[model samples]
Target: GVVGGRSVGVPGTVRMLELAHKQHGKLPWATLFQPAITLAEGGFKISARLNTLVAADPHLKKDPVAAAYFYKADGDARDVGVNLRNPELAAVLRRIAAEGSKALHEGEIAQAIVDKVQKHPTNPGKLSLADLADYQPKKREALCHDYQVATKDFRVCGFPPPSSGAIAIGQILGILKNTDAAAKPLQDGIPSADWLHLYTEAARLAFADRAQYVADPDFVQPPAGSWSSLLAPAYLADRAKLIGAQSMKVAQPGNPGAVKTSYAPMPDQPEYGTSHISIVDAFGNAVAMTTTIEDQFGARQMVTTSAARSGGFLLNNELTDFSFAPADAQGQPIANRVQPGKRPRSSMAPTLVFDKATGELLMSGGSPGGAAIIHYTAKTLYGVLNWGLMPQQAINLPNFGSMNGPTLLEEKRFPPATVEALRARGAEVREMNMTSGLQAITLGNAHGKKLWMGGADPRREGVVMGD
Candidate 1:
C-alpha cells in the first residue's frame, strides 16, 4: 500500500483486482465476497492492536464513524468482540465488483476524493483535479540478482530501491554468504553470544548503506550493481577480516545520522496501503501482487455522497516521510524536506525469486508490514533454503529485526532456548506483538517440485488457499 499525502494519486486498486483477478484463483470474485460481505453485513471484530492504538492515541476518536465502530455504547473502545460497521465501504465494494473499475477513476467516487483533498482542514494537500485525472497505475519489472554460497546458488528478488528492505537484505546476505564464519550460525552451533554480536554488526553496516543510498528510483537512481559489487565476496572478505568482536555504531555515509528527527512532517509519506497476493495460476501464469490504501486505513476521511459510497480514505500520511527539519540545498536533508509529487521512500519489498538454471519461479512472497517486511521475508527464505526447514517451520520462526534501534525479537513463537541464547548476548532486545503477514508461492519443479506455498503473519487472523 502506498500512502501518505502525496501518494494520494488514485486509490481504486481493489477495483483493479476485481477486474483482473488472477487466472488461477480457486474462488471466483463473487465467492470471495461472502467473507468480507459477511464482515460488513455483520460487523468487523476490533483487533487487540487496533484497540490499543485507539486508546493510546485518542485523536483517532475524532473520526466519529471509526470511533463509534470501536467504542462501547458509553464510549470506551471495544476490546475484542466489538463489531465495527461500515455499510458505506461494503456498498462501495459491491459497486466496484459489479460496475467494473471505471466507476472509481471517472465516476462520482473520483469526484468526491478530488473534492475532499482540495479542501482538507489540517495540512491541506494542494492536489489539482488534473493530477487526479492524470493518475494511472504503472507496472515495472521486479528487482533481482543472483549469488552462490556454499556451492549452492541463490537468486534474490525483491522490490528495488525506494524500498530499502530488498537492497539492504541483498547487501547483508551478500556479506554473510561470503564471510569466513562457519556456514551454520544458528542451529545450536556458534556460541549464541558470539553469533548475535556478529549479526548485529553486519546489520549495522547494511542499515547505514540503506539510509544513505536508498530512495525512490524516480528521484535518485540507485547504483545497485556497483553497490552490490562492492559488498560482494571480495569486499565482504576484507570487511569480515576487520570484524573484531566489539560493537561499532556508525553513521550513514552520504547522509549522516547526525541529522536529528524533526517535528515537521516527512515529505513523501506515500504510505500506499498495500496487501499482497500470490498465486500460481493453473495455466502457469504465476501472479504476485501488492495492493494497499497506502497508509493505515488510508487518508482517514471518507465521503458518503448519494451518487455512490466510495473509498473515503485519503492519501497516506507519507508526507511525514521526508525530512521535516532544515538542511542545506542539494535535497539532501537540510532536514530531508519532502518534495511534492516525489514517490516517498518505502519499505515494501514484494519479491519473486527464480530457479537459477531453468529460470522458473522458485518463491514468490511479499508483505504489507512496514520496514520489517524485508527482514521477515529474509528469515523465512533462510530457514527454508538454507536450513532445510519445511515452509510451515520457516513461517513459524520467531521474527527478529533491528535497524540500529533496540533489536525487536518476538516474545513467544520460537524455541525458548534460542531466545534465551540471543538475550544473553548483551543485545538490547524488544519483544513485539505481531508478525509480518507474508503471502507466498513456491513453484514445484524438477530441481525441486514446484511447490506453491503461502505463509500469513502469525500476528494476523488470516489464512491462505490455493490449487
Candidate 2:
C-alpha cells in the first residue's frame, strides 16, 4: 500500500535483489554491506542538509531517537562535523539481514511498524493493518524497447512499470540519437549554442510526457504499447514542435499538486534518500542496486528491540512522491495516485545496454537522484556510446538536465559563456547542484584489453570497485 502520498510501496527490489545477491554475489552480503552498515552504526557525520531537514520536522523534537540522531545535547540540530547513531537502528538492520524481510512486515519489525503507523498521522490516515499484512513485493516481467546505435540495433531493457526509468530515459535518448538535431554532437567537435538548445528542448518535451503518463505498471497500463514504441521518427517530429530556439519559461502551476501544499502538513522531515551499487560479473549478468532511507534516515522510526547492533535503518517516506490530485477527466488516479497494492512512480532506472552480438552486457548502470535522474543517465550514456569518453570521464564531466522543469546547469560545468549561449537559445536557466550521484560499469574489450571500469559520484562520497 502507499504511504504519505503514493509511496513506491514496499520495495520489491530488496527481496528479489537479496535473492539475486545470494545467487550471484562474489562477496558475502556482510562484505558488500560493510560501508553503509559501518557508516550507519558508527554514524557518519550527518550532512548539513540532513541536520537542517531533521530540525524542520515537528515530530523530530518529540522522538528521542530522532533527537539524539540529529540534534546535540543542547537540543539544537547537530553541527556539520558531529557524529551520531541509533544503536536501536543498527540492531534492527542486523535482524533484517539474519531473519529476512518477514521481520519487517509481520515479525518484530512489523509489529513496531504497525504500532508506529497506528500512532502516526500519515500512515494511520492512509494504510490499514490488513493492507500491511497483505502487502507483497512485486515481481514483474522484464521489459525491452528497441533502439539503434549507429548501424547496429540495440535493445535497452529493464524491469517494467514500477521501475520506469530505463524505458522512459532510454526511449528519450533513442529518439534524440536519431534526431537530425543531434547528428553531429561530437563530430562538430565544439558544441555551439544551437546544439545545446536542441538537446535541452528535446529533453523538456520528453519530460512533459513522463510526468503525465508514467506510473506503476502493476496497477495501471501505460499508453497502448510501451513508451519505446511511442518513440518513433514520426513521434519525434511531433515532439520537437514544443521547443523554441529563443528565451522561454515554463509557467509553474498556480497551485501545489496532489494534496494541496497548505493542507499537506509535512511529515517528520528527513534528508533526501540515497544509496546505490552496480555489479556485473563474468557470467554476463549485471545488477544495479539503488537503496535509500527515503529521508536521511527514512521515517525516523528505529527498531528498539533487536539481537545485535548490526541491523536497523530509517524507513522511507517514498509515499510522499505520489501525485495528490489523483485524476483528471479520465479516471486515472493511479497516474501516480496511491493504490491498495500499487508501486509508486520512480526515476530509479537500473539499466543494461547490450551489444546483442555476444549477448554480453556492454554497460549496466543507474544513479541516486530524486527527479533529475533521466538526464543524469542521458549525459553519461551519450558520452559512452556516442562521444567515446572513458567511463569515468563521462560520469565526471560537468552535467546538465532539462527534465520537465527549467534547464538545470551545474555551477562550474557550464561556463559563463555557455550560460549566455543557453540563455540565447530561449531557455530559463537555473544554476543548481545537478548530481545523480551515480555509479557505472562497462564490461567489454577496450583497445583489445579486458577491462571493467567503475566511477562513483564525488558529490555524495561514493567509491568505485574493480579488480
Clashes of each: 50, 18
lDDT of 1 by residue, 248-328 (tens): 544233221222222221222222235777766766776666655555655555554444332233344554444444344
Model 2 lDDT tens row, 170-207: 55675565456546564233344556666676676665
Please name the candidate that would achieve the greatest TM-score relative to the true structure: 2
- Candidate 1: stretches off by over 4 Å: 1-57, 82-85, 98-102, 118-120, 180-182, 188-191, 224-242, 254-274, 306-315, 325-337, 412-434, 443-451
In angstroms, the error of model 2 at 368 is 1.2
In candidate 1 the C-alpha lDDT for residue 48 amounts to 85
For all predictions, the C-alpha RMSD in Å is 5.8, 6.2
